[model samples]
Target: MSSPHPRLSARQPRYMIVAQALMHDIETGRHGVGSLLPTEAELGQQFNVSRHTVREAIRRLTDLGLVSAQAGVGTRVRAQRPVNHYALTAEGLSDLFRYAHEVALRIDSQEEIVADGALAAFLECPPGQKWLRLQGERFVRNEGESIGLAEIHVAASYRAALEDTNRPDAAIYALIERRFGVEVREVRQEISALALTAAQAKRLGVAPGSPGLRLVRKYYSSSGELFEVASNIHPADRFSYASTLRLRPTGESEN
Candidate 1:
């Protein structure tokens, strides 16, 4: 008989396997939005694991926002949306672009605009200065449903760099880096709850007041000057952000 696959690592448990199986069921249409999962006791017996183990597995899925539980009504499946595991760090900087290109998403628009107050203040530029604006909508290639939208603005000095390649699918940073030898060395980000503006909703084709993700970013060059400001809107069903924090001793220097 073939040897059974070795048990999962002692660190994270087989929660990943359980999570995967559940995801497959959801993906293949066996279970769908609002579908309820078997009870904890039933799931433990089904997976041949203890109730505690089952609870951990369920918690893993919950953290990803794929499942919800009611006190007595069992866990129900949430809308099956893209589970984008991303880091708000330099290493993961290319994820948004990757999502657009790899998914064969269509870009909606790209242009240059003069910044008004909020945009001017955010980019630390004076009002009416020319700023390169890249506005685009991305949707699943075959599905044809709008997945998200990105509004990116950068210094107009990079205008020539974007001469003819400003498509909905263009990578703004790539063009700047290639032409002006400017690399986006670091990105600082802050996330907050933002209600969609009427125009924002119309551009994205979503109802006004629909939940969305507000990703505000400042991109810095090697010299540490902030040169780009962007606000990306992701529908509540389209994304989830993840991060980890480590605590240090109180008296230790953060050097």
Candidate 2:
């Protein structure tokens, strides 16, 4: 007989684990909207983690608009769902590709440059590599508020692909596939929170140093070659990421 144990990957940070648990409870009605969550110390004890970890988890919930925290007043559930209603909801990893059609990118400038220093590190490329950098803002169709500021970089060899496209608002990967036959078969994405720079804040119509969600995505071709890298910054109040998950049945091995 096969063992019931499932293969697992590296563990996530404690804060993330705690945050996901709280999110589950909130979603399942254990913690209803307008209800106050347990104290950080109590949560820490219940989860067997430090109060700092619990605090960080609560911070994540606050960022998602699910809860609000105030000094001496305890954390309160603000909503069951995230505040932003994006034109496109990335319910799964593959759903990101559909963003080009759902939320159009309005290209502001296209330039060729040699990457070095911070830019090279950000793209995971060596210094002095040639790149075609496209800077733009993403907006929901028929909406007035700009949702995100994006900086996308494609290898210099692919510059012609973007230049040939009549629809500057289309996704970079789609443009490359149409013109150069390069297919993006896989995507690696990272999400984090940081204070927005002055330029990004101005573009998103938020004050400087306001909290923002930073998304870094790397696109890989079918041959396992990295083809494109993009960094997008969205105001915390303006964008939210979500996905649906289901539990596995007994005796089922993960795919």
Candidate 3:
């Protein structure tokens, strides 16, 4: 086995620290692709942790596409570096807000525009309405690679709400609410499949014509007024959205 890694700080979870150390070993080639990692018991002994902790660490590696584990077979290093796979499990509006907090947006450009016929149709607003459009890439917090490109349009009245776009801690809609006291009562979302254009592929670091997903969300206020429209494009390989559906009890009426 390789030399034991130095002790990690207690600030983070134990499994995460163990996972980080193992990931470092893989990236440094100490654990080559196709080679089996140290057994759970061995890892536990080396890290002075429980076998359960070691297992959880390996699970984290598996989630990142770095390693694979099979019954009766040791975990094998699948890749030298972590794959940038982002999965969002949205069950409610709060979950959507949580997703926004998990990803940081880096705005590339901004402009004030009057919605033309086509743009107005997309935004579900009347033609000639003014909007503040912001374009950006969304990254997993503290990671370098971007997972998606985002285009957001805010009603020109709330343009001032975005004055602190640099703040990654709050969602844009939340900012609008805090600034203008307009509550977002509903969010309508649509997902569509598309082949990425060359320009989009260049910005997203994917091949032209790659399969992708476009997600558009329309935010509405309590009075049934649309205030914001946001769209995000994600490479098929990098992002997945999941939702849970529960079956109603028997005899439950559709109405």
Candidate 4:
């Protein structure tokens, strides 16, 4: 005979368990979007966990962009669907790459054009340099929402690599490596707040003038040659990014 409840693993964090349960409640319509969630005391009692554990769980929810907590007011749901939360630990600087796996990126179009004027300046490309551009949107699994708009521009030399594959969303860089037999040595990332343009807003299912996050990344080879540049725009409410930083002792050189 099977036991009604299995023994819990000691390695599991209580806060994570509580968080998952709360997220389930949110996803299943137990707690609708824009609605206030139960108080910490209530949630603690319901989950049979400590208030501290509940607090941590709420923190996780906050980090995921599912809910927002106010000082006097209770936590309120911010999104209708489960937020795609990415946990970037200290081991990797390529946090956005980790995010790529969690969301579905469907390529909408691809084109080759010579970069000039402001576009060349923005891409850091020399005038008249040719680039292959892939435009797409990112969707969360099981959620029918376009959370982000992405534009990837590859240097002309690697354009054939992108053409060799049908599923650009899955792993474009890996394909490039296989095609060109080259490896990326460094990834430079920059983030900024942006107001959505009308076109971008329409594609991302957000209102014009809405606040969004702009992520710009540059991929380079061992010889310091730029291979690709990518820019992604995410609605402020639908996406959240978090990273864990480790403090090192003084006088320790970075590897």
Candidate 5:
């Protein structure tokens, strides 16, 4: 006898498959905005999955800002597309990809520069290194308000990747990987408190001297070569960072 449920592909997680199907439904207006989704039991029955599986799928939707759940009310469609925000709760590199998808950078200027002493220290590179510098403002896709000022410095070798920086949908490192046939094996990030400079404040529409956060990320190749450095300065009210911590299981040793 054939199985009662539809065949699920082993290539992707079961919950993810269910989530993608539901997201498509939401986007197509099958489940219109503000409409409550079917209850767990109903969804489970329709998908021929357990209630736990349905709940997990719903949780994925919630993370993308597509729906919300309350104790008494059922899950409601919040938006057709993922909501853009500077707030990030990053667990790993994958989370960074999600963030990149939610926001876009609008380049305002570009130049080729040889790193001076101060620039070299900031980029974590030796002095006199040639780089293609791109400056821009970051925003929620299609929205007007700028959230941060961004400076992206790419090693001169991969300057060709700049061809697609205008493609609002592409990530810089991904562009480098595709154009240069290199892999970004690691990303080092540093965050610090700062006061917005007058120019930065003007660009971000924030007041000078306002408290802010400076985020710097260095992308490295599998062979330990640094390929790019990106720095973003965000107004205190516009951006937030969150992290999760978990305790190790018994008998697990720290690396």
Candidate 6:
């Protein structure tokens, strides 16, 4: 049995009612970074209000940087950017990675390694090809939460670029583009079910073997050449991906 969600009474102004509920969600981190917010239709259905009322509520939230809308993408939770689009992206990766490093997220190791299996497939080179591996760990910034571990596998050729501090920034791909003239134009990631290792659990502040999001990402260059591959372990309850998709009228007729 579960308790009901808190809601303003029907007697109150509809916009105020919806706005309050949405604010509560933001304050509680229920709609944190990468959280795709419910659609106007969904909110209207949930609040038993008209779409116009829902729109006004959304507008208020948007003004607060708690929500954002794209032309084709309806609305997504603004990523870590306290202003807007907070989540880390290709363009923002350098800054976020630099911030993480500045905030004492340590880089454990950087070395050369030969990868086989799926990692090989993602890097798209012959098995045992030399790759530059970067292993780093992130903490909660203030609290010692030990967020998780990060591992990036880049071509050996990128090592020099990453080591160049004079470059734009330290994010591996960002450095590759600015220093080595390599541009990552696209990326694909895969998430697999996994039990956390003791080290991961300890770092994530979770029990050993706890379910986590094991992410594998393949980044490609502007020439459509595969450039880097990365594997990350994120606490399941703490990590998520959100995308906003606009809904077009199904009954509409096109010229």
Q: Best candidate per TM-score, number?
A: 3
Question: Any idea what lDDT model 1 has?
Answer: 0.68
lDDT of 6 by residue, 144-175 (tens): 44445778788887778766332123455666
Candidate 2 residues 1-255, lDDT tens each?
111113222387888778877877787778898899999889988888899999999999987878989899999997776555463467665688776677767778888999999988877789999998888887777765678988889999888888644336567888889889998888998899999999878777667998888888899999987779988888877777776678889999986
RMSD from true fold, candidate 6: 11.6
lDDT computed for candidate 6: 0.66
TM-score: model 4 vs. ground truth: 0.68
Clashes of each: 0, 0, 0, 0, 0, 5
Give the per-residue lDDT digits (tens) of candidate 1, residues 1-255: 112224433455666656666666666666787899888888777667788887887887776667878897889987475344322322365754454344332335667788889968888878898887777765555565665677778788877875655353445666677778888887788777777778878876556987888877787899987777767787665556665457888999976
What candidate 2 gets wrong by more than 4 Å, as runs, is 1-91, 164-169, 247-255
lDDT minimum window of 10 residues, candidate 4: 1-10
Residues 1-255 of candidate 5: C-alpha lDDT, one tens digit per residue = 112224446687777778887887888788899899989988888777888999999999987768889889899987787654478898878886666677788888889999988888877789998999999888877787777888999999888878745644577888888888889888888899999889877876556897899988888899999888889888776678997878889999876
Model 2 residue 252 CA deviation (Å) reads 6.1
How far off is residue 239 in model 5, in Å? Answer: 0.8
Give all candidates' CA lDDT scores.
0.68, 0.80, 0.87, 0.77, 0.81, 0.66
Q: Each prediction's Cα RMSD?
A: 6.4, 13.1, 6.5, 5.7, 10.6, 11.6
- Residue 124 C-alpha lDDT in model 5: 72
Off by over 4 Å in 6: 1-105, 139-144, 164-169, 247-255
Q: Which residue segments of model 3 deviate by more than 4 Å?
A: 1-80, 250-255
Candidate 5 regions off by >4 Å? 1-85, 164-167, 250-255
Q: What is the lDDT of residue 78 in candidate 5?
A: 77
Off by over 4 Å in 1: 1-21, 27-30, 63-65, 79-106, 137-147, 166-171, 183-187, 195-212, 221-226, 235-255
Q: How displaced is residue 19 in candidate 1, in Å?
A: 3.9
